[model samples]
Target: MPPPALTRLSVDELVGMAGVNPWELHDRLMVGRPEQIDELANSFHRAASRVAEGDGVFGEARSCFQGAYSAQSGGDTINASPEVTKTANDFQLGASQLDTISRSLDEVAHALTTAQKTTGEYVGSLNAALSQLDAMAEAIGPGSGANEQQYNQIRAEGAGVVGSAGDLVTGVVTSYQSTLQDHMALAQANRWHSGSARRGGDPAATIPGNGTDPATVKQWWEGLSATDKQRLIDEHPDRIGNLNGVPIADRSAANELSVDRDIHRVDDVAAAHHVPSDEVLAHPELYGLDASAVTRYRNANHVLDARKTDANGGRNRTYVMAYDPLAFGGKGRAAVTIGDPDQADNIAVVVPGTGNHVNKGWSGAKDSISLYEQANKADPDHKTAVVSWMGYDAPDSPTDPRMLTPATARASGAALADDVNSLWATHDGSPQHVTVIGHSYGSTTVADAAAANQMHATDVALIGCPGTDLAHNAGDFHLDGGHVYVGDASTDPVGMLSSSPLGMPGISVAGVDGPGLGDADPAGVNYGAQRFKAEASDASPGSFVTFADHSQYYKPGSESLYNLSTIAAGHGDSLGDQGMLAVHRPSVAPVSVPNPLGGILGPDRINLPNPLDTGIGKLADPELLRGGVTDNHNH
Candidate 1:
């Protein structure tokens, strides 16, 4: 694998061969360890490859280290380390920290390798000179006209070759010995020198924080030992799953591992009790007897299904952000990311609304894949991460009283805010843009969260919105008016009834304030939002086309999907300034509703055009009519 070992020679002979009196301690050593140096170099290269690819956190840092070695190593100078630490959020701190040590060795290796190459070239030049002199001596025969000149040249060149070779050999020996010692000393000082101790850290008690602060959580994650990480996943998967700021890759790994453990746990229990799992699957509350265990098994299967393999047989990674069956009094909350958010250049989080449940998969994995593919098509160069974030107990049937108010949105808003904030916190600068897209009632959730928490996002999109409460205009969101986009279609009766125009039926029925009681509808012209085409056509500006209905905005071929992808790719500016599907701004201006309760202000207006005569009332249930908008219209 390497060049044949250099022939060994005694120290005195080596000194005499070099003819250098300046050399001191080198004259005393009898043995050489050139092979040890070669072996150590191999080890360094092998470790570098693993550290570079094993975890996403370390990969960026590794690249920076290699870049430094290449650019400055040749000059025999070391500058300050750039903040490559930003890339590696999971660099464990302790005696076993190897990232810095590895980098240090890399720098030394560059210097040593350069020195060795230069000395070898010197030795080669000497050998070449001696060969040339021997050839000239043979050609000349004896003393001729130019024979004397040739002989002098030959003697001088031969002597020079001998002297140069000896000096080069001495230099190689001295340099290699010192470099080897430096490398060995540094490795020994770091506990990570040995493979066994490389993964060491403190116990679980030392785990920092409650896993909220992204920076702090990353630090804590890095400080943990190998055993600690595994134990956290096994013991507190819910905490691990919902913990924001942890890398999605790690979360996916932890979740999958927990899923496996959960399956085994259920199987072990079922086997011990002679419980028929077939019967358990059929009716968990009845035949299974242990409803809690059945819930665990079901959640485990949900994760297993999510672990489906791609065409290339690679497991599609899924981050289980939140998974708790007993959350919000049994309604539960779940969030999953279809791709790695930390490494992507663009990230979009989709929140689903009405009739969402774990059984129905609030935001199904299939749905996530479709969105992911759409984003890829939108911007092929930048890696896009799409999140199916159903991190709340969403409202069920429209008949439910809770659906009429903003209570569900208010409670879930806090959780949604935390989820989005975590992304910004853990992100290592790749994703320059982040967008939050909410559909149907989910739109309302996004609005409520953004308004309450001042959510950090580059863009906020509301699709098929059903009254985003209290948002009188797009500017009411955390982002500016230009950053909020809305898509709604006229054929969608849900969109029509819910859009809070002057004296709108849906708004009045909520028992809030005016007809436009809840929030200004994005399609109502006055909401000050950008709404472009959504009807799956390549028509010009004046061409007529039907917009998609409430449930069809996300369909593959729909115009809404195209527009959404465009916006997600940060091309919203291309559409210019035009609200989609709204031919004219609301003709009748909104009149502020009375706020007799002092600071309880809202955009409640009177003397407005009632939407009842427009037949929007016929589509609504009687309960909606009974709530207060039946016949109270001023014609």
Candidate 2:
């Protein structure tokens, strides 16, 4: 109830009032049309029901997705399910509030209409009494005793009528006020606002676009209110899920939303084509399913399955740092972290080499977990985060000719640099000790990143590397107060392509001069990289080296893994004598060797160790099993 429309009046003035004012009462109550409120309530209810339908669809789709991962078990569902459920609840809450408002309006409207009618009846009685008084005054003349008495009676009756009408109006006003107050209190308690209301358009539209500096994005994200942040996540998750500058937890949440949406998108396509969701991924051709849809489905499931694995083993939490299931012509790209990179004291970004994609998530997940465990073991006092980044479109096969060129690495290097720079931007406190580890062709990619794309890292390790075409020496990496490290097994054919001390004619021509894939061997004496022991002891006597050595660097309990873990944990100096390898630089000049069977120009044997006896010893040739000796080992 608002204050009276008119000021306090004398009793005579009250009697003189013409009629009750229902318009003023309605205006003060602020009740809109009841029909319109009902419509709004219906809209809310429909939205709530739609959300429930979406929830069911995701549940069904998740079942099909989980089937792909486990034989008979189900994988973890989307982490966004709880948030989705809350969103549905919010919709239902809106409907409930709308209903209450509509009913309250109806009640107030009825109360005011009834009060107006009752007040009119009282006014009618006062009008009739005044008529009678006027007649009596006319009949009895000016000073008549009867006229005076009649006049007094009519005045008293009119006053009574006014009092009754006023009291009735007051009662209606009080009831309306009580109802309004209760509604307001409920709204305040629930923190209720119009769910569909927004001052502007979607908040996500205001976010900076891709390729914006991650630091700039971080600042923009921080400036938003919590409500706006949640609104953006709820409405437009894909915009920021894979964005580099966002916090890990928020990115995880946003990626989860995108994962759920991806599942729904794929399932929707399958449904449109009358293909069963469970069978759509296996027989994508049956429904004319696009490759990207299938890829998105598989990648989404991979993320869920990884989380399930961690949950079952009580391992460190897994966060999806990057998830783009539809990028790169269906090859897709993704990155997952074994620990929170922002909070960890040491962080390692592990880039996979050739033959990797989002579909092959198990390999990356295993590597990430293994590296995380090793890093934790190396420096137990400090926490380490390892991110397995399969964010590039890696060549499908190791033998692919693309491996002989820096084109692919160059194309993908900027993305790697941006990701690394983003880590520094989003770190929690003082800058973390960041290490970038690249295996096989991934090393070349890392080289390109640092050399041309402005990658910023503290330390870099390249293992089983073929060559670094862009980076001719360790200094080309431009590490911040840290050294580049190389781990090449003597027998590893791929590693030999870059670090072979023999400098064999055909090998050099094919690896360096011909395709020019890697002209700069990081393990060479002039390259200035710390050499680490990654050689395996199982080389055959007759054969130069087995291919098995190529993939053994990351094996647990091995010297190479130990050294890598130590460096990743920020304890590179603690590798001691056993882990470090001495530099090996064979003379570049060829020598005429008088072979028993034929004459050939071989590498200078004086500087090259016997591959069979010493296994191409990292130090100057050790006293060989055949009695040969060399001195002057350099690390």
RMSD of each: 33.9, 36.2
**lDDT of candidates 1 onward, in order:** 0.55, 0.63
How much lDDT does candidate 2 score? 0.63
Tens digit of per-residue lDDT, candidate 1, span 137-232: 667767676887776665554454454444434544454454445445545543332222332432433333232355556766765567878888
Candidate 2 ranges beyond 4 A from true positions: 1-201, 264-276, 282-291, 307-314, 499-515, 537-543, 577-579, 585-587, 590-635
Model 2, span 319-424: residue lDDT tens: 8888888765566778888889999999999988888887766355666666788788878888999888988877678655355345567556757887998999
Location of the lowest summed lDDT over 10 successive residues in candidate 2 = 623-632
Worst-scoring 10-residue span by lDDT in model 1: 626-635
Clashing pairs in 2: none
Q: Pairs clashing in candidate 1?
A: 531-580, 536-559, 593-604
Each prediction's number of clashing residue pairs: 3, 0
